[model samples]
Target: MALLHRAELRPSKLELLVPWLPGRPWFAGEAGAEVTRVAAYRFDDPAGEVGVETLLVRAGDGPVLQVPLTYRGAPLAGADEHLVGVIEHSVLGRRWAYDACGDPVYPPLLAAAVLADAGQAEEYFEVDGKREMRPASMTLTGSRTGRPVPTGPVSAGPVDSGGTVVRVGEVELAVVRQPVPADVPPAGGLTGTWPGQDEPVLLAYAR
Candidate 1:
């Protein structure tokens, strides 16, 4: 139940992206841009020590993108290449960080969130194309361990805006009434080969 503020979650590492945003195939920012964190918040993880944090970033000429991440203890042994930029904590007095996208714990947590947030009670759960969806009531309590176990299935969808084209998975399966964002084109959804993967899937249009 402990919530953290953007400033409280200091960056263990901060690297400037002079041209990173524009070149990203999924990024919507204008070419040759400079973006920064506009907001951030942490979520609980019931079974692990490190928690999940979502950083709301604002790229030049783009809408905010929610980069879901986790701060880890040891640098992920093989994920050195995916590091976004480490942050040195002024309060904890130690450098603590890691990317959950590269970590193993994110998929299930995401699946559970989609079900709980959407209020579906009969869906299943699985990871890495394992065909593992089960019926339960789960909630993503935090990025750290100790979350409640009421699990459900996750739906994927595209989240294009500004100049970026990122996918969001584990959305509630319930039929949505909301209009899809105008910036996100219809053809831009999750596309992968794995069955259990939470890749983005496009839904209703806003014509």
Candidate 2:
């Protein structure tokens, strides 16, 4: 389970994202628009140090944007360009945030989820002196096609960070940057639905 602290973030996640969204290639929303969190889900890092989360947010009257981010205790080497920013966590001290795509630690986990029929990590919150289960902001599940899982580390291409298509080992996972079109092909990958969404859309899929 992932722990949730009641402590505050100096520059809130939204504060960091609002300005960064307008510059991303996959971002089509209006700049200077109010950014609101739609939903978020997380994956556990085997090392238990890095934090992996996929955030769904909307800017103005735009579509839900999917952003995968990783929070680290220190700077990620050779990932200067993908650095989102530095923020002070009231509980965890300073953190360096980066786009998960370039973090090296994210792809294999994503690949595992895509091929192993996995789900998001459970969340736990501590209050007073007690630990309690905290409901996820949204739900996510993974389904695998008939592909073999990788035994070792896997890599994704177009690693400049966000991409429309990411090649993960034998399966190429396509990112659904916006709402799914009516003609979207049925495929296996991580899928989720949020409030007001009529159908569950593929957030990422093996193509």
**Which candidate achieves the best TM-score against the true structure?**
2
* Model 1, CA-based lDDT: 0.39
Q: Per-residue lDDT of 1-207 in model 1, one digit per residue for the tens?
A: 323323344433223333334444445555555666644444457564665754445567675444556676556666664455555555444444544444455444544443233211233233544445442222212122233333443223333332211123422222111112233223212111112323322222111
lDDT of 1 at 31: 56
Residue lDDT tens for model 2, 1-207: 788799899899888888888888778677978888888888888889999988888888888888888999999888898899898999999999987877777776776676676778888889998989987776666775666765454444552233455555566666666645233345667777667665776777667
Q: What is the lDDT for 21 in model 1?
A: 41
The RMSD of every model to the true structure, in order and in angstroms, is 13.6, 2.5
Instruction: Please report how far candidate 2 places residue 134 from its true position, in Å.
Output: 1.3
Clashes of 2: 0
Error of 2 at 188 (Å): 2.4
Identify the candidate with maximal lDDT: 2
